[model samples]
Target chain A: MSGFFKSSIGRKYAMALSAFFLMFFLLQHFAINILSVFSPDAFNEASHFMGTFWAVQYVLQPVLIFGVMYHFIMGFILEIKNRNARVAKYAKNNGAANSSWMSRNMIYSGLAILAFLVLHFIDFWLPEISTKYIQGDMSGLLADSEGFRYYEELTHKFVNPLRVGAYVIAFVFLSLHLTHGFSSAFQSSGVSSMRKEKLQIFGKVYAIAIPLGFIAIALFHHFNH
Target chain B: MNLTLKIWRQIDANDKGKMVDYKVTEISEHMSFLEMMDVLNEQLVNTGEEPVAFDHDCREGICGMCSMYINGEAHGPDRGVTTCQLHMRMFKDGDTITIEPFRAKAFPVIKDLVVDRSAFDRIQHAGGYISVNTSGNTQDANATLISKHAADEAMDAATCIGCGACVASCKNASAMLFVGAKVSQYALLPQGQVEAADRVKNMVAQMDLEGFGNCTNTGACEIECPKGISLENIARMNRELLKANV
Candidate 1:
């Protein structure tokens, strides 16, 4: 087990597994968030279930926290190791011709995503935690009217142009990160094959589509009357 | 033609290398990249200076012995050819060609233009070959009919000469292509079925133990490989490793 963590492929396996978890989390989060745009009642009900469920709070949340930390930390460690792997760089490196820009610059895009996570946690996760644990004022968090707190808080957050711009830009970076990372995770996990082009196509579509959907939600909220 | 050569020079493994410039003139276009270096070495020998050291044998490009990172590309700029097969016509008369050894943490510089590639040998020893009953009458591998596509893929993978070009060209200095090709060569063939699980696991373990970096799937290895080994080999290895893990 110790030897597995030290191995390069093993480290990559961890990354692939964690990334898969995060990808599923992204899809789930997207679904819930997208619901708020149309039906706040459904959104509130789902959010209530997600928020109040003891198994989700205790079990899955901890797993997600660990997964996020593990994925992000390992990414940085791999980046540093990769840098040290090449002690001396080429005097003239034509990396563009050899591979995709996103593939080579994974660390940069990853750092950007990490930065975005901080703002994300502060905006959403932190407030939910405060409402649940710190203040212990659950009723203060509810807005069951046509003016749903679920919709209201999200729309209010997007009303700030800078914040909306940041969200849009972060999602753009997310797309870039996933452009290489999506297919790459499958490649690392051995889910990809030579005979089938499904993974690659699915990867590109997901990379583009998911981020675009997130951007749409952000924009839709910002423009909400 | 006159050319300015910027070659890496170092006395030993511990010593730091610096690019030393030299002039080689009146070169023929038909001369190979190594022959051009030989011409420069002859000039240095005629003078009172120490000649440059480089690795080369089987100058026809089969041995994978001729390793050089020339002008940023592994085995020079010519596609699908090792340093031994690269001709002078690829360069202009006044070209300033910068030559350096392959740089990877796993491949420490032994001297000028030569690094230790024993890591690859160790990896190969780990699980690169199959255990056959050579002591007794063995089943001839040729007796069985393999699909042409599989055979061709195996042939393509078997073409890897262990040149370390993949490591040199990769940003992360990953040896995935080298190990991938070796693993794929056997994985695609029927004879390699018995120890397939152990082979994948052992080779990958050895590869990681060799201080090599992880594959980012950059495809640099295939682009710069002298033999044009396909990236599908790496994919096959990944599949095999997954199967092994399962």
Candidate 2:
């Protein structure tokens, strides 16, 4: 394990595996969030289903959280190690502008995504899980007796131009982050082939389309309200 | 033609280098970039000042020894040409060109524009060779019929002179193009396939050990490369690396 961590192949595997894990969450999260676009009640139903699933809430939730933490920590540690190695090897300024701009700014973009994650959890997860389910607060947004207020809060937040604008901005940053991360995740995962070329095109489309969808929903709610 | 040079001057590896200005007059346009530098050195020698030190041999661009970062470019402004192939005509009479050595932790400065590129040699030594034993040239040259396309591609990959320009031109100082070319040259041919897995694994391991950064596939290395080595080679190496691991 130590030798694997120290090797290039090891690092690539770690990057790929972590990215794959994160991507799983991304797909599920997007699926859940897309519900809000169809109907506020539909999103509430999905949230209630998630909250009521004892197996998911007890077993899968902890595992998913572990996966997220592992992915984030490993990605950051490997990036730092790779950076230090590069700095020590090249002490001059000759090769500063030849690579992709996204590669150079991965860490910064990652931090931005991380910051957005915190705000996202506060806006969505905390209220849905803590305020409604845990604390049993049946207020304006959490008025549903079924113990699910995700859609109400989401619609209410999107109805506010400022909140909707923040979501749009965050999604834009997420798209930018995905532009590089999508292809890079594949490469680091040791999946570089003609398959990757197809995947790259798909990755680019997904990176753009998903974020745009989220933005569209936000704008729709803001305008309709 | 007269030209002003802002050359980097460092006493040793420990010294902090700075751009020192020098003026050279009566330069010929036909002279190669290095020959122009030679003229400047001759002038400095006559004036009892130390000559600007740089690496060059063969002066034919094939040797890969003429490494220079000129005016924010590896091997000057000429595309698909080494510094030795770059002529004085590329610059004007009043051009203030900044000349510096390749900068990377793997490539340390030796003097003015000279650097130690032995790290590349070390990486190559690590696993860049096929372990076939030569028994007095027993095999005929025509014994193996490589396809025309494969032969051409292999040769194209083999065209890398190991100049360190890839590292010099990369933003992260990544040696992906250089290492990729080396790996591709071997991996494409049957002669190199016997040790293909080990070769890629070892070479990539060595490349990381030498402290080169990751390949971002930005296409800059391909553009700045004097030989026009493709980024496809890096992709090929990535494919090979995946195969080796799995």
Candidate 3:
């Protein structure tokens, strides 16, 4: 079993597993975030549940953090090793002739998404942590208002045009990353070729729709705020 | 056709190579790419200069001996053909062709355009064969009934001639397609089932030890392959490896 994790295919398989976990998490995250546009009350309730539920806080959140870290660290390790394999670069490499740009430039897109994640954590997660743990304010409330603080915080972040622009750009990069990554995860997971074409179609839809939905949510909050 | 040839020239493995320009005039378009190289070499020999060395044998393309990265592509710009099989008709007059050896850390350039692909042989040595006994007590050839689909897919995987085009065409210089084809060629058959797990594990380990990169599914290897080896072979090998481990 240890040997399995050490082999090239094994490493790829492990990367694929982590990617699958993160992609699923992204879907759920989008699902909840989109609720802010339709109904802020429901969004706040969902956010409060996810933020403070014992099972989520004590169990899944740690696993999600580990998954994100593993994916990033392993991706960098693989990229470095891959670069070292060819010490001499081709004098003229026509990469566009065969592979998609998104497929070849996954690392750059990932880095962009990573940058966005830092911003995301600062805007939401850090404040939430401080409120719950440091301030011991588990009421999920506002200082001057009677309503939950989650929706207010969420909408307030998008009110700034510059922040909204950055969020939109990050969502575009996320789309690009997912365009290759969704089907690629299956290929890395050793899924057979027969079902691959259908999965690719589904992957395309999901890649485009989820990010577009995120962009709409951001724009809606920015305009409404 | 008249063309300017910018060919890589190197004294030996230790010497850094450079492209030397040589013009060949009145060349027939019907000539194969290697034949044009022959003409250039003959011109150099007549001029008291050492001819550029390149690997080629069985100019028909099955030997897999000929390997050249022409104009930023393995096996020139033509599809489904090795360098030896490429013809001058693919180019026009006044076209300047650039030819270089396949580049990879594992495939060191031996001379002008000849790279040492012994790393492939080492990978094959690791676990690319079955353990069938050939001591005159061999089982009947028709004993096992393989499905037609399996046989065809295995044959497709087996068509890989071991040329390094896949590696050269790959941006990462990955040999996953080669190893994948080799693994699939065996794993698809009943004869190769006995040592399937060990074969994939050992072959993959040897491939990594050769310093080849990992596959990113760019599909370049499949497109540039002389035999049109499908990307399916790669996915199949991935499945085989996973099945072996789990």
Candidate 4:
């Protein structure tokens, strides 16, 4: 009760809240990525705002980073505790009888998502900050004051098949992760009722939609000029 | 019916357990799971073999003493019943049934099919009771009016038999559902309102101290629960805990 966030259920609550927070960011990030496909100018304007705005950069990015890290830390912490919970495991235990396959294997999906995140940051977020702020090179990034290299860098990155394939696979894992994570998040923090049923249904849809949407976007950029 | 049984056998908590096979012939389909075991033990004793040791009492399933993890399920393949209530009719002739004790770090195997579930008792003692007035001047039970919805929910939560099936069914062996039910039973009633805040906090703390895993909401507990304890109880407990902390 004292360190509310440190308790078992409390840590789960924090993990759930963190997962929801990161899901919000994923939606926003997807919105920005899709904008590039429809209107590069619009994408550039949004990217410019996202990159240059003080609150978006200093305040939001730091918090978002912390959220991602917190989620990872809690995920592994729970995994370790869970492993130790069953010191003597069944020799012929069958898991598929009651629970979904994805629900039982969250750790593997999360690890895959974590791996993809490293590559994602390298391809996008890190380069964005490093080139502009750290190295102080603003060469062709702001070309003609009408274009942004943020869009150019996106196209440049997706032009490679290897990178696009990784994105596709990562999104697949992301979809699986969300299959359980989405609905489980609400349940962890005590969100239920007819709304809980609706959340479960919506969670299934979102688990497939958002990640598949990301994969489609990646492929759209990959095969096209 | 002649059935093959692969039962887990261990001398004590320190000895490594393994599945030992036995066969019982002319088994009646109407026999309860434990009754079938009785036949096997009689055969073992006649042959001067060590009979298997499994826990049971009030074989109708009310006592919650039967703790067999039969054929990968906590209470055999049947839903909403303990192993003792499970009948031989559920199995076919020549079928192989694997029986083992509920395995968890907190519930160490005491023998063949019995585990030390006193961890639950300790947890209950930690905060599963209400302060009652035994003096002659106690107030009337009807002095307080509780909503029907709350009363029913409390009753439903109170139906848990401390069976530990939830822990057995869980991949992580988490006891969130059990603790949730205990906490929710009191959380919904007026008699329990006085100590509500401390009850949730202390019960959850005791659960953690018992070395139970965190609830990842896999939900096998609710699904396999004999009383059909809802996962919503866990949600209620989480909400109660958060409210208490705040």
RMSD values, in order shown: 2.5, 3.4, 1.1, 1.6
Using all chains and alpha carbons, the TM-scores for the candidates as numbered come to 0.92, 0.87, 0.98, 0.97
Number of the top candidate by DockQ?
3
Measured as a fraction from 0 to 1, the native contacts recovered by model 3 come to: 0.75
Taking the true A–B contacts (Cα pairs closer than 8 Å), what share appears in each candidate? 0.55, 0.33, 0.75, 0.75
Q: Is the docking of candidate 3 incorrect, acceptable, medium or high quality?
A: medium
- Can you tell me which runs of candidate 2 are displaced by over 4 Å? A1-5, A20-24, A54-71, A86-97, A131-141, A144-148, A159-162, A189-197, B26-29
Local distance difference test scores for all models: 0.87, 0.78, 0.92, 0.89
Once superposed on the true structure, which residue ranges of model 4 sit more than 4 Å away at CA? A138-146
For residues B1-246, could you state the per-residue lDDT of candidate 2 as single tens digits? Answer: 889998988887788878899998989999999999989899999999998889999899899999998987889888899999999999998888888788777888888789999989988997788776588866786898898877888899999999998888776577888988999998888889998988888888888888876655456688889999977787778778777766
What TM-score quantifies how close candidate 3 is to the native fold? 0.98
Compose the digit string of candidate 4's lDDT tens values, residues A1-225.
457787899999999999999999999998998898899889888888888888998999999999999999889989999999999888667677778889999999999999999999988888787877898764436555645687777888899999999989999999999999999999988986557997888889888999988998888888776
Every model's DockQ: 0.52, 0.32, 0.78, 0.77
Clashes of each: 0, 5, 0, 0
lDDT of 3 by residue, B1-246 (tens): 999988888899999778789999989999999999999989999999999899999999899999999988999999999999999999999998888899999999999999999999999999999987899999997888999999999999999999999999888889999999999999999999999999998999999999999888878999999999988888888888888887
Q: Please give the range of 10 consecutive residues that has the lowest summed lDDT in model 4 chain B.
A: B55-64
- What's model 3's overall lDDT? 0.92
Q: A1-225, model 2: which lDDT tens digit per residue?
A: 465556655666666676777777777877887887777777777777777678877888887778767767866875665566444332234334455666667677677777778877888777667765678754424453654566666667776677777778878877887888888777655464567889988999988988888788788777876
**Clash pairs, model 4 backbone:** none
Write the candidate numbers in order of decreasing TM-score. Answer: 3, 4, 1, 2
Q: Against the true chain A, what TM-score does chain A of candidate 1 give?
A: 0.94
Pairwise TM-score winner, candidates 2 and 4 = 4
Q: Which candidate is the best by TM-score?
A: 3
